[model samples]
Target chain A: MKFVGCIAILAALAGTALATEIPQADRRSGYSFMGPDSRAMQDDDTSNPGMLWVLDGETLWKRKAGTAGKACGDCHSDARVSMKGVAARYPTFDKALGKPVDLEGRINLCRSNHQQAPPLAYESRELLALTAYVAQQSRGMPIEVGNDPDLAPFVAKGHELFTRRQGQLNLACANCHDDNWDRKLAGAPITQGQPTGYPLYRLEWQSLGSLQRRLRACITGIRAQAYEYGSPELVELEAYLMSRARGMKLETPAVRP
Target chain B: MARPVLIALLATAAFAACGPAGAEGLLPYTVAGDAVPDSLTGTKGDATRGRALIVERSSTCILCHSGPFPEQAFQGDLAPNLSGSGSRWSEGQLRLRLVDASHFDPATIMPSYYRIDGLTRVGNAWRDKPILSAEQIEDIVAYLVTLRD
Candidate 1:
């Protein structure tokens, strides 16, 4: 009887130990991407060259696009209040289109629906600057999206994409940003993957890029199959990332080194 | 299947037992008090206290840096080796670094542990004070200076 009791006690101890050993689930489990440093550059022109885009955007807002006699300023008198905090809620689901939309997509929507001008192509300086200028309006607002039920499916899809492993590295976005953020891979600092600040001026790229463009670059870095511009996978990924940065304030036109 | 599951659970428990207390084993970096010097070369610091600070989960210093110390196993190799930092930098330069590494490398992800000025957008909770105290800085500097190799 004592032998049996001893065996049971040892088994109980083993079970208790195992239960405690489970790895803690990370909140950022699905996607892998570098996070911005706390002291990274901001939208101000003094910190980064990309801040020039905000100035250019101000000019573009005043200048008319297309043959139509309408400028962004014609409808919205002042971008400061009118467009402020607008960038923090992007990559949102649009009921009209029945899909997710990004800052560029929204810009095109405005141009086609309101201004009747041709939508700018991806990476166009005009679009980048305008987006930068517009995103800068919400410089200090915390990111908030997917609060509605309509966005749940898209957010879920994005989460799946973030955690799923891909590419030659056989690594998922979560593998680096979530699991190894604090641990460095090369010579760079590993930070929490937060997209609260974007349309950032990176010293390496020497220009501004949309969040979608940044995502594409990351895919390239890991040697994964690059998604086409504005693909659903990229859009979903953006939606998820914006949601992850829900409470973090936006710092559009952010500078990076 | 049950036996394998049981073995896996046992292994996991063993690993968890080795991790820092209250960290849930997720935080891999050593947390140090704000006493460590930011540079490798500097005045003598308290290695004994520095060791405690580095092992603390909140400081998060060991997240990206590696050193010759064996206790910190989760260090990432992204930054230069800090084992012999004392031989590389001076005390004043080390002071400047602990205050704000971003001033030196604009893209650095390291947080500013010292300077109370120039912060624009950090969360309200972290804004009022430097992460490390002046004495802690001195102690860390002194300790790092001991790392000759």
Candidate 2:
């Protein structure tokens, strides 16, 4: 059955190759500069409030956020060294719940167990920026998740969710993004499924957001019931994305259009 | 019944005439009048130049599309394949797309590469000129037309 599926996919690819003639100029794929809209909005100043959160995070790194009075710095210091490559391993499986967990969940975990602070709200600039800064520390690191034995089930679940069709359109994330990626749908250029960069600045959103937020947008585009912030489905999906981008270098806070 | 049939035939003829060719020619960027020609000749276009333009950090075309090209390991799968776009579309049609596809489809999110009236919302100093020059467009068109298999 798997061999049949593979043959079918190959036949479809061959048919498509014969059906459409791609332009040579358009075939040169890879990274490109931000479009006009994205270039204009980029904040060159590292001192911008968003960037300033890193300084605050630096403070919060040492100062306790919870009633326990135990600071993040108390447990983990030298973020440059300790947190190095940490962000790239996130959205991993949690043995306690037997499910995947994202960076936000991990942060909240620290808030409850260590610093004892209230969990930061979703879309909060402070939370987003702090997450951004921490993730930025792991820039250039390759994604490495789901290697543990207990993580296998969650990774498999994530892969299933990545390709499963859902929503009103009966379309999976792979449909428009993977299958029809080079075709002009209404006129917008389709991009490949790359999740190595997050906390990205988008022209359409006009702000920095997490990869989960972007996934939610895709879900909405297909007219599906959006998974709530911090939902299990989103965490699983993130795990799948991280796996797909296993070897790609992290480009946190990347600008996009 | 005869009068209605005559009207329908006339309407169909008018529509066919105004289809694509009747639309305005390619618009100019910096120079006055239409700097873009109806057809290109000479060196045609350098595929090497087109390749660099597609991958340049400022163009944003590669953000959505993917191809079999060697350098694009990070290519996305969200848009249509561009491996043989030249054969599918005419040079004039390609020119229109580069200028302003929104004229054909209002809801299109693609930006107008060239607009001489003014690019107010883009940037402070940014003008109506396209990121690539007319000659560059010719080069890209020439390169695109060559994709066969």
Q: Each candidate's TM vs. the true structure?
A: 0.56, 0.54
Q: B12-128 in candidate 1: lDDT tens per residue?
A: 664465423442312112213422223222234577887667545455555556777687656767556778777887655555566557556433445556544444333334434
Write down the worst ten-residue block by lDDT for model 1 chain B.
B23-32
DockQ of 2: 0.03
Error of 1 at A61 (Å): 1.2
TM-score of 2: 0.54
What would the per-residue lDDT of candidate 2 be over residues B1-149, giving only the tens digit for each residue?
78657645654564465423422232222211222334322236677787677665456556555654666655544456668777777656665565555455432334545443322222222333455555676666666666655
Docking class of 2: incorrect
lDDT minimum window of 10 residues, candidate 2 chain A: A21-30
- TM-score for model 1? 0.56
